[model samples]
Target: MKTHLTILLTLSSILTFSQNIKIPSDTMVVTTHTTTVKGANINYTASTGTQPVWDKKGIPIASLFYTYYERNNVKNRAERPLIISFNGGPGSASVWMHIAYTGPKVLNIDKEGYPVQPYGVKNNPNSILDIADIVYVNPVNTGYSRMIPNKEGELPKRETFFGINADIKYLAAWINTFVTRKSRWESPKYIIGESYGGTRVMGLANELQNNQWMYLNGVILVSPADYKLYNTSQPVYSALNLPYFTAAAWYQNALPKVLQEKDLLDILPESEQYAINTLMPALAKGGFISAEEKETVANKMAFYSGLSKKVILQNNLDVPTSFFWKELLRDKSGYTIGRLDSRYLGIDKREAGSSPDFNAELTSWMHSFTPAINFYIRTHLNFKTDIKYNMFGDVHPWDNRNNNTRDDLRQAMAQNPYLKVLVQSGYFDGATTYFGAKYTMWQIDPSGKMRERFSFKGYRSGHMMYLRQDDLVAANDDLRAFIKNSLSNGKPAKYEKD
Candidate 1:
């Protein structure tokens, strides 16, 4: 009888512990720390916590894990700027920008941004935290965030949190709750998103304004992924990639000696002009173009892309980026260039394949990022949870339909005079070429009425430009300037004819 009682008690204790590990809908763990940013000693409070996502009945349906950093001893918190940051992947945690970009601490990587051993974080000297309080938010299923089951053990429908529109809707609601809870309604606000996050924040800018009734002063897109041009085989899509190809080729020293001798910046304008004026029109002509024009375009593409004319002709002048990655160094070297950041190279089992076996840059990043985030969240932030930290979660079957996010940003800017946009992209980012980002920016406000309010900055590195030391400092400085310049300074929010 005694043995049976002990066994039952042990089983009950295990069940209770398991239930506790399901992640509380609303909970917080706060820790205080001091760090120097840009030679300024700063003290800040890190609030690592989970905020509940409620259903229509106001019942908790999910929990979003976030780390919010606010500088301590602010004279008036209402006047300070608050930067809400998110990384992309639709299913990616906010880890990339959290530690590597604008956060107070950064990954312990080398100056060039390659991962170093002893994977941990160090104080980011160039963190924008000195100018603004920042919050890194992980959407549902990413990081420690997860959906909750009801008393009947029924999970919320995946449709609520996995689609483009669905993501914007819930996150906007959550932001409203967060701002209200923290009493930051009067604060100047900016939303920055990277990659797929670019698509997200574009939709969010409008969603927050119309639905949540919350407005932002600025929107920052970091290597933004505009889906319209991503997988589409349109002439614009194929042509826009030419400039990026030129950049990657230049970096690899694969371009002709004439182009290579000229500085990268000097040669890029030629490539851009060719892409817009020559290549786009030529590609649009398709096979109808005289064979002479096809050959002419092929020769120019070879000159710009560092690929032979034969290969360019083989693709019929619409050279897929995958083929470029595979063929760029096929003769010179057997290495395959990375898809996201061409600076990184990988060894493939066979060199004759059309696409790389894997994304070399992503794999290299995961090696350092995965362990650092897991360690930082648990140890530094002191948020204790046995839940597995998902770098990339399973939020798939993602509904990407009705993507009016690009236009949504335009509308948001139109509605709010104080709203401004700053687009930053890396020259060598093949996945979402810098030129494509430029095209997206231009298309956002077709009227060009809001052109002055929009700005673009390009870095020499890849998608996560901040990973490179020089770009990190420059990028944060750019953010500081953008925030400061976008502030209303008590001026009324209205268009003025100067």
Candidate 2:
């Protein structure tokens, strides 16, 4: 398997076209201010501490640590825009975005996440700090950030790191201190989130507005998950059927002769329309129709999706993504394909039955860069610390599991009535279906008359669309334009139809 997963400049902050993790000693001169906030103890004061990377023995080491950075209206020849960024995993670090994508200086990448040696880091001219001063945070466990250990530096997995409410509360308090120190009460603040980070950002947006009586200027949700809990849980069998068939057809150039005649862009509308209007309705009516009728419908759907009618009938019109992997690439070697995107072929012909092709693009790379970056912060960024980086912390399950769409969305909208949401997705991103976002946008009040406030574009890649240079460049352009217009007029163009 020739893994194309070389250096992917996974979208966002503090990195670059760079190489090497061990960083040289440098002083950050990280500044701070002080204030009080309501916390578990109510004695939470805004203070800056040189977070040290502590050893298992609870000894402070000059490895990787975190402190605090604040400067409200950072007088950038004028008042600066305030922006806070974070990475998602329910337990990931914010360094990925803060250090790699938005900070003043960044690690390097060449359009892709490939390293530009001589320390794989550089001054990111593209850093949005020019317009929005950025604050990057590390959640409880993921980075060098850690908590008191129970036994032998080993933390409590259950009590501390296993749920969601605790996560948000701490994050809210952390932000309070962060903002108090910087005195950014006057600047227009914004939040940028990626992947699961989108969930965190939106959730945090609600918290910030509700608790602090503060509102953000805008929000940027990258590859958001509106309802993945239920969406991804769709009858896995049918869930697998559509996208797999679509990806297979795209890969084979076997789309309907008519769709193939036009460009892929032109064909997407019908494809998306079918998924929403036709396939969705059919699936919702599963078991309602007679077996014979179901078979007929499945076959017609198969032809429309470019799969063989026999294959459709075989799976009873609900061939899962896994089976599509085998069926589509069966002639080649019968290897199942990757889940993140079926374009990746596997070794086995049928279901893994036992194992699978590298579960996803993010798994390995996320594992790769995470520790390296932690080490980088300790040595290079030089804040000081002893906090564990909870790359994917246990969610405040209660808070998010029963998340309120109207309350959450309303709070966010009402807080930043002028909030502009810029969302982008890849058409092939079955992970966070592009249509789901479109649908969500349709549901939000601001989204209805705020079309100009929100903008979405689809590319031909998977969830991490930035892996492709063209898609990356196009997205960057759209973002730059969006940022520029947003600063000029805080209110987005009122929602309108495309």
RMSD of each: 5.9, 10.8
- Writing each residue's lDDT as its tens digit, candidate 2 over 1-498 gives 011111112111121112422221111333222222111111111122223323345443222223333433333523456667676666666665554544443454445444444444444444444344556666655554444333353443433333444455456656765676567777767777776666666667777778767676677777666643434455422432364356446755666676667766666666666666666666666667567766766765765566677877665566655455445545545565455444444464344343354444455335445655655554544434344444554434433455543346556775454677777766555556565556656656653554556777776665555545466556655666666656634445243357
Instruction: Report the number of the highest-lDDT candidate.
Output: 1
Runs in model 1 with CA error above 4 Å?
1-20
> What TM-score does model 2 achieve against the real structure?
0.71
Q: What TM-score, computed on C-alpha atoms, does each candidate reach?
A: 0.96, 0.71
Per-residue lDDT of model 1, residues 97-179, tens digit only: 99999998899998778889899999999999898999999999999888887777777899999999999999999999999
Which 10 consecutive positions of candidate 2 have the poorest summed lDDT? 37-46
How accurate locally, in lDDT, is each candidate?
0.89, 0.53
What's model 1's TM-score?
0.96
lDDT for position 181 in model 1 = 88
> Where does model 2 exceed 4 Å of error?
1-78, 98-125, 149-165, 228-261, 290-293, 303-307, 314-316, 322-327, 333-337, 341-355, 367-375, 383-400, 446-452, 488-498
